[model samples]
Target: MSRRILVIDDEPGIRQALGQLLEYEGFEVKTASGGAEGISLYDSYRPQLVFLDVKMAGLDGLEVLKRLRQADPTATVVMISGHATIQTAVEATQLGAYDILEKPLDTDRVLVLLRNAFENRLLSEENARLRETIESRYEIVGRSFGIRALLERIDKVAATPARVLITGENGTGKELVARAIHRGSPRAKKPFVEVNCAAIPSELIESELFGHMKGSFTGAIADRPGRFEQADGGTLFLDEIGDMSASAQAKVLRVLQDGVVTRIGGSKPVQVDVRVLAATNKNLEDEIAAGRFREDLYYRLNVVPITVPALRERREDIPLLIVHFLQQLAARDGLPARGISEDALRRLQELEWQGNVRELRNTVERLVILASHATIGAPDVERLVGRRSAESPGLGGLLDIATFEEFKQAAERAYLLAKLRTFDWNVSETARALDMPRSNLYKKIERYALQRETVE
Candidate 1:
């Protein structure tokens, strides 16, 4: 399809010339005589680009430009005039004109500008799609009271600048809550920098939070800005903050009090404006009782305490969460799409998800990949999913099988191994549990070379 160009000029000659040029250049062209007609034509024609003359009889081009922008914020209009002053050009741009072209516009410049404009629009549209996808991916998917209460808390605290302390188990989506707060806050457009305190070694954690000058340590080859400085005018998320060293905790306390940070091995205090949000699975009060976490820092960050409910607490939402994970897996990961039987879903909900939502999502992905049929049955769930999925690979590690026979063999071996471990390697109990003859169970175990392990 060709690009659409609308030429709006009171001068008949100018209109005819530009219209002819655009049409010759393979653009679908339309010409309007005045501002009112141009605005009216825009409603029907809906051109992608417009050339509007500045000086006109009743309503001027600037007035039309303003009206067009008000009607459609994405309208791309270029102002054209033979005697446009600097003020007129600046004013046109201020009103969201794509570009201001002098009268007797250069044909080459017009073509290049259109090319760049369309490319930029394509990128903007793509960015909008990615943002929508991300927002949907991280959306809180539940209608249970716990989730509703959590959402209410998020809405109340999101708009404020008060420090928030998010408490939840390892996979209960603490980061998601933090991101939700940042997205709703006034600093949504700014960068969100996160540092996992537990992941970094304690000896270097202070430098990681405050930065370090060159030659400050063995690996310090250059000066680097830390998480606080990087998050200036934005949000700083300290994940697993209870694991922070005592020195780093004191420094964080000082920065929270003074709004300033001094680099390690450098005494210059640099100011920063950052909203601190922290998350941890550990109980800070217990840490304080043990003399590990500072009480002062605990009070500072605990201004607005939010505890994310575990998956077991919201069992009613398991079905919705399963559906969401299935769709997300198919869309985002390009995994094969599959459905779950009602009984299978019930069985999943019956199990204790010690790892919470993260574990559920992983199990869904595993089923999508490993299940034999398009709709997974309760037997498949029972065979593939183990009590402690965090420890055992089970069917999740069966992807390397070459063919159907190999896949069957690998799955059977895993299932038998899990059963044997569950029965503590008792052949009679394992055979009874499997509902198979003792001789067959022994032969299968011997053939597969199953061994007893202390734990999964």
Candidate 2:
């Protein structure tokens, strides 16, 4: 569709000339003779770009620009004036004018400005669409009472500028909750910046959250806006907040309290209006009691606490989740849609999902990838879960696991050891067999304290 451009001027010749020029350039043109008519047309047409005469008869361009900006802050209005002054241009810019055009409009400059304005609008629209697509990917997908109640709470707080702290076990969709809130909020059109505190190194956490100036640190080559600045006027999701360093936590608390952030090696404190949503899989209260987390920071973040129920707590939604995952995965990967037998689904529900919804999705993906038939059966389910189950009596059996973390560690150790044995301790071959980077494999080996077993 052609972009709409509005020209508001009292002079008939200028209006006619500009209208003809814009129309010839393939823009949908709308011309108004007076300021009142221009404002009315703007209200009706909602043009993407507007060219208004600064010295109109009754209501001037400045007033119209102010009104347009009041209606839509992102409106693109370029002021055209025969007798232009620096003060007038500055005032127009302060009133949110896109640019100022000299009285005798240069055809090349007009075309270039129009092209740039439309390109910017297109980019902004594309960004909004991408954000929507991202939010859709993390849509909450259950109908249980727990999920329904959570959705209700989300609706209640989504429109407001309240801080939310989500708590749940790993893979229980804490980030999903945060994204849902952002998608439903008033600032939905703005950025949604996320930071994983646990994934980033402690030394760089400050820069990652609050940004840094050029030459701030050894590796700082250029000025960088941190997550907080990037998320200005929108939502900032801080995941794994419990893992943040003490210094970073204090800085985060200050930002939350004062709505301002100072970059590393910079003296200026930049103010940002951001809605913060934080998530953690660990119990922050316990961390505070253990002196690892600050109590004051906890209270600041836990304004409206939301605890996502574990998969076991909402088992009724397992079948629905299974079906959703199956269809979604099949569609995404261009695989034939697969079905899970009732017995298979039942077996799945009976097992504990220590990783919650994430574990379930991974299991479904594994089955779809490895299943021989279109319909997955109980035996297939058993074999997949059986390998990771603590009770299975084999190389993968982890019967001694006392906690979920221990269970995961034992499974990793067993799997790594078995793969290493299968490949005759060839690290490259074993890493290839496991489809992991060699460095990651080596790290896992070190983390699990894996050692070669002596032959009898």
Candidate 3:
């Protein structure tokens, strides 16, 4: 598609000539005789670029430019004037006009100016879009005390190159915190690499961390750089660090101590400058006691510990998070944005978010996509949250009447049932979706005396 350009001038000859010239250059051009008509055309056409004559009959060019900026701050408007004065040009520039062109216009200069303006407009838009994406990606939109405190801590730590250890339960936005730290740090312009320690196999862990030379192992057909080398001069996030093998922990400690890495089957130890950020759900002290994690590595990585508060701990943020997610989902899917009722939001705040912020986001997305009503109400939240009515024989009612042990059993049963329903009663799907081993799910089903007939 051709780029659109709006041409505004009082003189018919100048408008016709410029319009013709722009059209010849493969631009879709529109012309207006005066400032009022130009503003109207600008709003209607939404042109990417505009050329406005300064000395007009009724409304002058500076007023038009100001109004244009009010309508679209990113709009690119070039001012053309036959009686060009320094004062007039400075005023136009101050009013956000893209450029000033003195008239008895040089057609060549006009074309060059137009091209520069167009390219600049494109670059500005692209940069704005990128910033928007980054903001959305790391947005922790909430007003709770816990969230505010967390943001304050982020502001403080982001200025330093400290080795940060983020401790949080699974699905509590630990990685998001890590990314925010990297983006805010001095080395934000450099790479931010991540390695999931729990996902890599024990045998390949060394190669994954420190790289491997060609023919070093069964899979090493070529030399490759690892996470530490990839994250040189930047920050490397090691997730689920407690699950890493003891041997890998020892190697990581060595790298931290020496600030260098030696790849498998490589003769030289390559020096690297990397800031380490590690995260885990397990207690590192307990792991050390069990001889599964290295104490030296733990101390090295724990230079600055940031514990992400669980969702339940910050219940006040639930409503804010819900609103943020709803707006995000609606924008992404091109659907009309909806709101949750105050009562519904309060109910959500009362619930225990075992899966934390991640779980809450998924719940909001599900509701936005699947809810029948435009405004989410308490009943809708209850249904989506898998909460049964107190009158029913499920956990909701059992909690009120049953003893502590009985309530615990009932709650466990209810949670399992909810997972089963979420996965359409496919045992494998339910187990995987719950991040539990299939055999364990089966054992729980048997121990709870869950009837196959009931599940079906």
What RMSD does each model have against the real structure? 14.7, 15.4, 14.1
- Two-way lDDT contest, 2 vs 3, winner: 2
For residues 101-198, what per-residue lDDT tens digits would candidate 1 score against the true structure?
A: 88788889988888887787777778988998898888988987668878888888999999999987789999999999999999999989999999
Two-way lDDT contest, 1 vs 3, winner: 1
Give the candidate order by descending lDDT: 1, 2, 3
Report, for all candidates in order, the number of backbone clashes.
0, 0, 0
**Candidate 2 C-alpha lDDT tens digits along 355-429:** 889999999999998887899999998776673443552522245446886567556766786698789779999
TM-score of each: 0.80, 0.61, 0.63
* lDDT of prediction 2: 0.86
State the displacement of the C-alpha of residue 213, model 1, in Å, after optimal TM-score superposition.
1.0
Residue ranges of candidate 3 with Cα displaced over 4 Å: 1-124, 333-336, 388-456
- Model 2: lDDT of residue 169: 70
**Quick one: how many clashes does candidate 2 have?**
0
lDDT of 2 at 52: 95
- 180-269: candidate 3 lDDT, tens digit per residue: 998899898889999999999988888999999999888799999989999999999999998898888889999999999999999899
Model 2: pairs clashing at backbone N, Cα or C within 3 Å: none
Q: With candidate 3 superimposed using the best TM-score fit, by how many Å does residue 451's alpha carbon deviate from the native?
A: 47
lDDT of 2 at 49: 94
